[model samples]
Target: MKNRSTELREALEEMIAVGTLSPGQHLDETELAARFEVSRTPIREALIQLASMGVVVIRPRRGAIVAELGPQQLVEMFEVMSELEATCGRLAARRMTVEEQQALQAAHQACKEALDSQGPDDYYYRNEAFHEAIYAGSHNQFLIEQARSLYRRLRPYRRLQLRVRNRLSNSYAEHDGVVQAIISGDGDKAAELLREHVMIQGQRFSDLMASLPQLGKQAA
Candidate 1:
């Protein structure tokens, strides 16, 4: 049962990633169960798990739906991500082994090469690897898990942002800054820089989302 639930979760996550199921769209359990050729029981369990992880929302008598990023949710998520990144940076600086530091440098350079190629797809993949390397280098299991969870939740939106105006270049510079801070073993500086870098991007996104009625207004 657990295995089926995990499989269902992965399949649904891939569906979301590929845009097969657009954000905030309704998900039918019967359709999903037939698609997966599994019992509805596993599908229900998977949907509940995804809801708990913020990947989807389940409304009473309304079935399951993909989570849409409104102005409020986006801003709140970025704030959470900012804190997580700050914690990752601090831990990476203090706990990173010599090997891990070197790997971080190499990862940054690889990402830079991808950005230099001027391909969004290549740059996006490399950028993901770079951040994952930092998360792994943090050496805090709980922090790493929390960061990964939020990261997956934000994946669709973040993927969209990679194509925003000059966002890729801007993100490259931020990644470089984080690498330098971590390599220098300056935990406080790393934490501070990470917070500013992430939070500022969140505010910028919030401003954009605010102008659209499709995205709900963020509360003060």
Candidate 2:
């Protein structure tokens, strides 16, 4: 079974990712303890783990607050993410076992079902699994670790982007292309598709920027 600290950390992470706890919002240990019906020690441990993940900041005097990234920083991070995913795709195309390819397809199918039945939020979670399957297919431990770390830090923004009009459908369609390329052992094509799938540029960038204030207002 998962420990209390792990459970609390995941709960808090989801709250932040879904914008129930918006960026720059304070995380008070006392309030969190009361809310979770736990003591302060577990809350503090959870916050420390979140801090290590770049999801929250812990200051000496001010305690903990959700970490905030500027527009430029967000874009730069995505650019790096795109490159990392592209490499994963390329390697996976050449390296993935038959079993791993089957797993990736299963994950893609799960995303489709989530999109049809439960909409964007459900699709987002399944989509994460789909991408992680590709990450594991690469068989590169170091690359997988780096990709997951950045992916976790960017989870909230990525989730918010799916709220944009037609983004859910578009993302699912992109996943189709990525899956086909990898399964066909087309490394170059897989890399290209993965890069485009993850990169937030042009209108997507504008949409993300426009949506941030709305999320903040909703959180408020």
Candidate 3:
């Protein structure tokens, strides 16, 4: 079972990701505690965790507020995430053990099941497992830590991207290409596929921002 703080954090993050909590909006501890049927301590802890993830800001006097990321900032962060994932994919192609490969296949299967079931929430959970398997398969501890750190920071935004119309099917297709390349030990292909898979660019970025209009706002 999840801890109170973690569950509250996830709920708040989802609300922010789906635009229920707009960027820069104030987070009232009393209101949230009442709404979630929790005490102020858990709310404070969740807000602190969100602050560390760059999802919320904790000011000395003003308390907590949502953190805004403009499109350019989001693009830059995605670029870094793409490169990190590409490195992991490239290394995994060459270094993954047989057991790791089996695990990756299992994760992919789970993702496929979720996709076939047409549950966005389920797919998202399986998708994270699939990517984490690839990261672990790389056998590079430092790279895994870096990728995971960035991944945690970007989780909400990435989850929001999945809410785009028909994005789940498109994402699953991309995952197929990536999985095949990695399993075949095609380092270059795996790297390229993984890079493209995680990096939302050009028209895709524009469309995502348009779909979630709250995400594209300029910092005030």
Candidate 4:
């Protein structure tokens, strides 16, 4: 049952990422169940999970609808995300154990492999693990929970960001800077690199809109 829910959630998230399931569109459980050859039980469970992640809105009587964040809202969220990640990076640089640092290096290597040998979709999944390692390395339970909550809300949009042209290579290079700063125990440098990495600004924001036209249209 857990696997079924997770599978449905991933499939739905991919559809959302690619704009097949546009924001604000109602999710018909019956149709989804038929399409996936599954029971409504799994579909409902998946929608519930998506709701918790901010991917869908579950209404009292109207059922589930794909979530839509306006441009301003998205920018606001990104701003907060940047600060949270910077904090994680700073703490991780100072607090991570030798084993944790080794794990982080392993995650970074996996991200490098994904960038070289896989498509944007594969890179997106690896990126999640890469960021997760930093979050765990922070070794601060309260900060970890806070970062995890925001991370879940931003996951789908962040996944779509990888579709931007040449983003995989560019992001990998940026990750290298972050890893170096963290490895050297330079908290301030790690914080700065992480902030810049997560904060979408100017041209980067433009690229994001170009990559995801649905967001552009919605924000317009």
Considering every candidate listed, which one attains the maximal lDDT? 2
TM-score of each: 0.82, 0.96, 0.85, 0.85
Candidate 2 structure, TM-score to reference: 0.96
Top candidate on TM-score is: 2
Model 3: runs farther than 4 Å from truth?
A: 1-11, 14-22, 214-220
Q: In model 1, what lDDT does residue 70 have?
A: 69
Tens-digit lDDT track of model 1 for 1-220:
4599998998898666545676777999999999999989999999998999989999999899988876677788889998998999998999999998888888888888988888776776677778788888899889899998988887766665666667778988888788888989998988988887677354567544543332221111
TM-score of 3: 0.85
Clashing pairs in 4: none
lDDT of 4 by residue, 1-220 (tens): 4598899998897677656787788899999999999999999999999898888999988889999877778788989999999999999999999999999999899899998895777888788899999999998999999998887777657877887778899899999999999999999999999999999879888876666555434323
lDDT by residue for model 2 over 1-220, one digit each (tens)? 9999899999999998888999999999999999999999999999999999999999999999999999999999999999999999999999999999999999999999988885888898999999999999999999999999999999999999998998999999999999999999999999999999999999999999999975565456
Q: Which residue pairs collide in model 2, if any?
A: none
lDDT per model vs. reference: 0.80, 0.94, 0.87, 0.86
Q: Candidate 3 lDDT, tens digit per residue, 109-182?
A: 89889988988778988899999999998999999999987887677688778877888999999998988999
Clashes of each: 0, 0, 0, 0
Model 1 misplacement above 4 A: 37-39, 200-203, 206-220
Which ten residues in a row are the worst by lDDT in model 1?
Answer: 211-220
Ranking by lDDT: 2, 3, 4, 1
Residue 150, model 4: lDDT of 86
